[model samples]
Target: MQALKHFRIDFVITAAVLVVAFLYDSWAGVGLTAILIVVEIVFSFDNAAVNAKYLDRLNHFWQTMFLTVGVIVAVFGMRLVFPFVIVCLSGSISPWSALNLALEKGDPHTPGTYGYILTEAHPAIAAFGGMFLLLLFLDFMFDEDREISWLTWIEKPLKKLGKLDVLSVIIAGIFLLVASETLVHETHVHTAVQMRSIVLFSGLLGIILYLAVSGLSTMMEEREAAKDHEFEEADAHSSTGQKVLLAGKAAFSMFIFLEVLDATFSFDGVIGAFAITPDPIIIMLGLGVGAMYVRSMTIFLVRNGTLAEYRFLENGAHWAIGALAVMLVISIRYDLGEFVIGGVGIAFILAAWASSILANKRDAVAEGATDSTEQGANV
Candidate 1:
């Protein structure tokens, strides 16, 4: 009952969206919308786990902003408006034309259709999102401060390599160069040179954006830590309002980082949603509901201290993110169906959960043995 309360808002929102979907197109609309909601949730389950790590740092106020303002950005902003922007930019058409194209609901098979235009833009989208996610995985793998190692062999060496400055950047740059040259050949939409240029430039932008957000977030966190240290050293009791203000300021960069991270995660889902149905309205309704549930899950995990309880859960999520990054890049050349993409992440998460349970049992048995041995010695 307590756990169910966390999802009360999600339940209400999902019911309302489903009703709207049903009214819009009868049974067919409801069916497609249901599929989309499932699709979005499956594809982004790992995302919820990753989100909880950062969302937990935020105070109640900013967390509310994540649900409210963030939902608008996730739903309409990414699902509806972002696609229009992509169509306009990729098709070299005006916003009004793009709007018309979307409303027309033309066949995806036909060129110049909105779906076709978005599909045409997939390479650039994949490249940009892939690079950003790749860097995220690289940074996590290489972090020396990470005390827990899910895959000891891989993580330990990576942590040592992290001591080298800009190592993640160097590796990511090489990946972009190789992917741009090789993957661009797979698509003949533009000449090889043109396609390569698009992939390279877009991938570079992803890397730059990641660097900027991460650097700013680090700076803010360090500054906040320094202030806290001074307060502690001086034994000063800060006012509640002042502490709240400081927390909000410190969390601002994290908020921005989470938004960008969400955007990258959405790129694949938005594009893949077309494969299910090309109606932007239905897409928004379904994916929007799924996004809300993900937010609810994030907050639930934070409130329950799920990350601490299941120690390997976060590690599993990062592994899934790494796999997703590779898959996005590979998808530039081949269409690995949504099933494969979603399944890999799910598998990692389940495995991590199982491992955590086993570790707990082992500790319990060891502690029992020690206690029995001490009793025997006393006897």
Candidate 2:
């Protein structure tokens, strides 16, 4: 009951959204909307888990901003408006015409269908999103302070190599080059020397965007942490004020990362939604509803301290990100069933959870043994 109290508003709003969705369309429309919601939630579970780590660091104001302002970007900016923008860019159509294409319900049979436009445009999307996600994975995996390792043999060495700030960029660039050259869709007819130029350039753009935001934010945060404050109790309040300012800066930076991260996660769900139906309104309703739930779930994780308890859950989510990154690049040239994409993530999640339980049990046994040995020595 206590737990449910905190989420009463989320529950009410979610229920209201579903009710409105049902009322907005025919039975088939309602059914499609529900499916879209479920699909988004499943695909977005890792995204929620990853988001909670950053959101937890923020103060209340930033947290509120994430829920209110950030949700709009997730729901409308990415889920609704972004795809049309992608079509316009990829298909060279006007914004209005691109929107109409999205609304027309894509025809799989026609070679020049909206579905075809979106599908054809995927290489660029994959290049951009893949690099962003790969960098995200590398950053986490290479953290020197990270103690637990899901894949120690590989992760341990990566952590050591993290001494160089640019290693992740180097590795990611290599990946971009190899994937660009080898995995390109056969339809592209660029001169042999320039085959992967566009894709590679798009990936470079992803890296620059990531570094621009993440680097600036990190610099501000480190500067704040290095400031000297009076150790006397008389100055404690002033020191606390400075800490708040630092937190605010960091939170602002995190807000940017969170929005970009959410946008990357949406690429799969948005593209996949077209597979089910091309009705833009349905895509909006379904993905928007799911985004709401993910927000609620993120809050729930923070309030409950779920990540602190799970131990290896964040690691699993990072691994999932890595897997998804590779899969996106592969999906550019080949067809990957939606089930396969979703299933790979789900498997990692389950494995991490079970491992957490075992780790807890081992710690319990070790503690019990220590206590028993001390008692015997005292006796």
Candidate 3:
């Protein structure tokens, strides 16, 4: 019952959307809307865990922004305007024309339809999102400061390799070149030369964007750490204004990072939604509701300290992210269904949860045995 309180708003929004959907297309509309909501939630479950990890570091004001302003951006900006922008760019049309085409809800199989244009744009989308997410995963895997190891065999070697500076960037560059040369040939939307150019340019942009945002975040974090150290050394607290300024800077960078991460996660969900239904409104209602729930879940996890409770949960989410990054790149050439993508992440989360339980039990038993031996010695 206590847990349900966090999701109360999500439920209300879901009901409202369902009512609108039913009014629009009767029972059929209601059914499709339900399916989409589930799809979005299942696909983004690990995303909430990942978001919570960063969200935990933010101040209260920024955390509220994530739920309020962030929700508006995710629901409308990404779900509606972002797709229109993509169509306009890919189809060489105006925003109005893109909206008109979307309203027409033409068959995706038909070449000139909005859906067709979006589908054709998949290669570049995959390249950009794949590279961004790949770097994220690589950085996590290679972090020398990471104290915990979920997969010892894999993470141990990667942590050792982290001593070599910029290794992740070099590896990502190799992947981009390989993907450009090999995967570009699989697409029929553009000529090999054009496809190669698009993939290389988009992938590079993704890499550059990741580096820029992450660099800013690291700088802000270091500054904040320095300020804390200074205050501690002086045995004094900083003024409220100075603290707020530093917190604001750190929060702003993290907010940008979170939004970009959301966009990368959304690429597949938005594209995959068309496979289920062509109606833009329906897709928005379904995904919008799901996005709200994901945000709520992040807050719940942060407030409840779920990540701290389940020690391996964050590790599992990152592992799942690494898998998704690989899949996004492979999806440039092959159409792996949404189920395959979402299922892989869910599997990792479940496995990690179970492992955490076992670890707790083992530790408890070990402590019990030690206590018994100590008591006997004392006696």
State each candidate's clash count.
0, 0, 0
For 1-379, candidate 2 gives per-residue lDDT tens digits of 9668876876787677677767767677778888988888887888888999888877777878888888888999998788878778777889888867766776733555676777667777888898999999999988999988876778899899889989999999999989988887455334444536768888888888888878977876666555533332356576565434336566688788888988988888888887887677888888898898888788778768899898988888899899988998888678796778888987887788888889989999999999999999999
By the lDDT metric, which is better: model 1 or model 3? Answer: 1
What are the Cα lDDT values of the candidates?
A: 0.88, 0.81, 0.88
Off by over 4 Å in 3: 186-189, 233-246
Candidates, ranked, lDDT: 1, 3, 2
What's the TM-score of every candidate structure? Answer: 0.95, 0.91, 0.95
Which residue pairs in model 3 clash with each other? none
* Candidate 1 TM-score versus the reference: 0.95
Q: Which stretches of candidate 1 lie over 4 Å from their true place?
A: 186-189, 233-246, 377-379
CA lDDT of 80 in candidate 2? 77
Candidate 1 CA-lDDT value: 0.88
Which lDDT value does model 3 have at 260? 91
Q: Between candidates 1 and 2, which one is better according to lDDT?
A: 1
Ten-residue stretch with the least lDDT total in model 3: 237-246
Model 2 worst lDDT window (10 residues)? 225-234
